[model samples]
Target: MVYDEHESTARFLLPATGVTIDILPGSEIEVEVIYREIFEDGVYCKHGRNVADRMKDEAGAGGSKQVMNVKALLNVALGDRVCAAGVPFTLFPRHPGNSTLNPEERIRVQRGIVEPYFFEGARQYVVPMTTLSDVMEERGIERVDILKVDVEGAELMVLKGVQDVHWSRISQVVMEVPDIDEEIYTEGTIASVKRVLLITQLLKKHGFMVITEFDPNGKNHMVYARRI
Candidate 1:
């Protein structure tokens, strides 16, 4: 498989190896929302601006859709608020839960300033699935409508950190998952197809049904699931 010279480009050029099967839209989200803008796009970047604009537009008049974006370094379109967190990571072989970064890895990730390579570090504080909930609760976030997790290969791990009680609070999930096998990674630590499937099953058990699967590029699959 060919790898994109740049991380941002890869997001659009990669070939999708997995399939996104659609199910049905579940319920409406009427709570606080969390958009984990994991990787920072860039300062002065319109990425976040555009998202915020669209969200506000959709929300319409009197819509109380507050968003919290957790960032790692890169800039993002500002939202209701922003929080700093290390990139979440775990040893390969695909675990069932999440892990934190060691001191060394934390330093590296904080300073790496690069793509897939930074993800290859020893440890990082990238927010974990549970952290999202923690931040929400800390901010008195009672209900959550949408969670857009696009954290490279750690998507599955992020989901693993969320529990049933927390799941009940979530309305819709938009996660970017790669076709495990086809994903072009220099580090070879990306979650495997088996792992991604396990995540899917976990979501299913939690009452989420896949509503749509589409290739954002040819490399990764953007999955949208809603509570049923």
Candidate 2:
């Protein structure tokens, strides 16, 4: 599930994933073309491409009327491990680690690049996962307006690599957390229930405020925040 926030204060949730722009009264929208980049993670099934295409369509329709240049970092996985162990196994932008892998099992999992099932199910395989900081450093990006994180259960680990200085450059963030009753069990690991609280606390500590927490979607919780 996806939710997008625009300028207009349309008080209803549409329950869909598409690009929409709302030029609200008394609200100002600005578009700058100096190195416009859209870094998309979890590019499984080219979901990010679909989103970018939608954004382009919206932009052509008299929205973001500035001569904007768009760049993207789509489909590059963002996590600690390419895959982890659990009921069926898990995949990430990095290797989940071999702390849980047995001698024989590890050998087989390490043979070749782990591939994800084309469908919506988690079929175990080891692959390569990358990090946001690494990519940003490579591109010499000093600031990130929006950082959207949707790693299955390794969100915290990813955030760990972001230095405090980088926090100052980041203006907003959108992340997924597990629901209170729901537990994220993957790669022979179980994420803590305080995951959301931890994320909220950390972001707040870094000068960001948790402005919006979407209604729990039975499976996970979505939190949107901005620097204060």
Candidate 3:
């Protein structure tokens, strides 16, 4: 259960797996150089803390700041769109996909990379976005066998935030899609098509059985739904 829209935290090791990157915000050398280019060589270990402080010391919990309070770490009840959650829609400088800068010091700015180092005093965080029925009703989590998603292109806002009666308890799903055809309005349609044909018709209208695997050269695709 990791959600990185940026708040920052890290911990990893692969050969003998173990990873934890709860939240992401930026610059700790941009979160240890983008997960050390996606893992390898001293496999991460930023720590930084308060990612619930182990369920708030196993429930002796006093005012959870599992991510800066306000019903954070979920306890629900947030309306008025959570008091207009940050309105800075777009200005993404892009590097390691969601970079706010420090991609090797914005490539050691010679003369080109200086636009306030991609937001010198950048500030815009709203973080409190959850779904998959608010984390399977806040972690009672009956089932989710597998649900690997790579949010580079926001993969259909994380598969339409699951909930067609919890998409039949989610058997499997391995996302990372974006096979081109950009039009992006999705559930409202704006035209062009192929985001692997709208995530293989939204997991074949929920019954699953989808299977795409592009990248003959690279538009990046890899959808594989199950529950058939």
In candidate 1 the C-alpha lDDT for residue 17 amounts to: 30
lDDT of 2 by residue, 56-110 (tens): 7767897677435468744344543332221233422123222121223333433
Superior by TM-score: candidate 1 or candidate 2 = 2
Give lDDT for model 1.
0.44
Which one wins by lDDT: 1 or 3? 3
If both were scored by lDDT, which would come out higher, candidate 1 or candidate 2? Answer: 2
lDDT of 1 by residue, 132-228 (tens): 5455565666766567765545566567556556888887777666555323245667643443566577778889876435443334455667777
Q: Give the winner by lDDT.
A: 3
lDDT of each: 0.44, 0.49, 0.51
Candidate 1: C-alpha RMSD after superposition: 15.9
Q: TM-score ranking from best to worst?
A: 2, 1, 3
Give candidate 2's error at residue 5 in angstroms. Answer: 35
User: How far off is model 3, as Cα RMSD?
Assistant: 18.6
Tally clashing residue pairs in candidate 3: 7
Q: What is residue 39's positional error in candidate 2, in angstroms?
A: 18
lDDT of 3 by residue, 1-228 (tens): 223444554443333346544333333344455455445532111222222443566455655434343243542222223222332222232223442112232233212433345444433434344556657766667767556665445567667777688888877777756455647676877778876787889889988877676754335677767777
lDDT for model 3, please: 0.51
Worst 10 residues of 2 by lDDT: 28-37
Per-candidate TM-score against the hidden true structure: 0.43, 0.48, 0.24
